[model samples]
Target: MRSTAHTDPVLTQSGCSSTAVRALQISIAADKALVAEVRHTVRTALESWGASVIADDMAVVASELASNALKHAGSEASVRLRLSEGQALLEVDDSSMQRPVARRVGAEVEEGRGLFLVQALAAEWGWRYREDGGKTVWASLPVPAGSAA
Candidate 1:
């Protein structure tokens, strides 16, 4: 897996204007390899942003989202990580319109638990269709206190 990232100023949503901060985005390949790559990228990004406390949670959520995209969509995905106003946002874009379903699996089951884990880990999670024949699944996790975006 190969990725590229950059930091750019992002405007705040508050009515009062405020300073912008950097966000991270990476291009993800559509393969089983994406799972590890997503986890690693999330960890690295959060650590670099001074939010290592939430790195483990964010990485798990990212892996679940990216793995689902590659397994079901069969197309490359893009991941974006941003910290804004005390929240960490993660988005995974893939070329599939099929919304993810979270199923209740038995303890013995080895599959059908991805979305469930995502819902359990993320503060919020959802999906939206793109105009260009694809969709993006997004999750949000709160940034730890004293952490910088």
Candidate 2:
């Protein structure tokens, strides 16, 4: 969380850390509108980093993670973005300690493919569980040099 009285950017979490070139964080409700905001924030931030080519894919990743958090982890999830060292990372922190499982094409569902979509778009994706029980799912993609346009 950031504590800005007026003009100071608090950029570090107690134990949460990252190697992103630049980053942003937001607390979102378990609502679709809030999820949309996450999507937009990611697109704009990546665009600022000259990685606009991946904006749409980034937005899709955000929506997938946010929706999964709402559906499986409740409404207390936070979204974070990190753009560092030629890479863009998206993370969703949620109260649920349950690790996400990758669903097979017909594992036993009619339509459940959130994680699958993420895997397809992200260059790499993974998760880590906090000592206190919360979990963070992160995905990363390369940032192209001429992506901004």
Candidate 3:
């Protein structure tokens, strides 16, 4: 098992106190069948962040974002979970230049509601294209005030 400590130079030299737990980064191929596993991984990361109390919302947003990446974006992707400034951030990176823009849909449609769902559940969400390639869709949800697990 990996020790829960910041062993990287970036974390050690950044002046980031151990008081603020280092964030978790999970990189994996964007597989549709692994969505549940991705959600579970985010929940575990949140718990490791000492934010297990509000993990429910974080997990939902994570699931939605992962699903969006798998469905609309490419299979090569990554998920990152972090705790900072009294909030939790979930980021999904996929190898596609296309940013996720909301699309209108008819009631009869069976799917295509990923971004809408993310918008509803997350405190805030958006996307940014990387300078080299690809893009990331990210969301932030405030940890419940006064409840830091």
lDDT scores in order: 0.83, 0.77, 0.75
Order the candidate numbers by lDDT, best to worst: 1, 2, 3
Tens digits of lDDT, candidate 3, 3-89? 122313234355775435457776667567778877887787777667777687788888888888877775767887777657888
Of the pair 1 and 3, which is ahead by TM-score? 1
Please identify model 2 stretches exceeding 4 Å from their true place: 1-20, 105-110, 146-149
Which residue pairs show backbone clashes in model 2?
20-84, 21-83, 21-84, 22-83
Q: Candidate 1: worst 10 consecutive residues by lDDT?
A: 13-22
Report the number of the highest-TM-score candidate.
1
The digit string of per-residue lDDT tens for model 1 on 47-116 reads 8877888889999999888888988899888888887667889998999988888988999988889898
lDDT for model 2 comes to 0.77
lDDT of 1 at 9: 59
> Residue by residue across 1-149, what tens digits does model 2's lDDT show?
22111112334565465333466777877675677777777787777767888889988998899878877887668888777656778888889988999877876776579899999999999999988888999999888765532
Backbone clash pairs in model 1 (N, Cα, C under 3 Å; residues 3+ apart or in different chains), count: 0
* Better-scoring candidate (lDDT), 1 or 3: 1
TM-score (all chains, Cα) for each model: 0.88, 0.78, 0.81
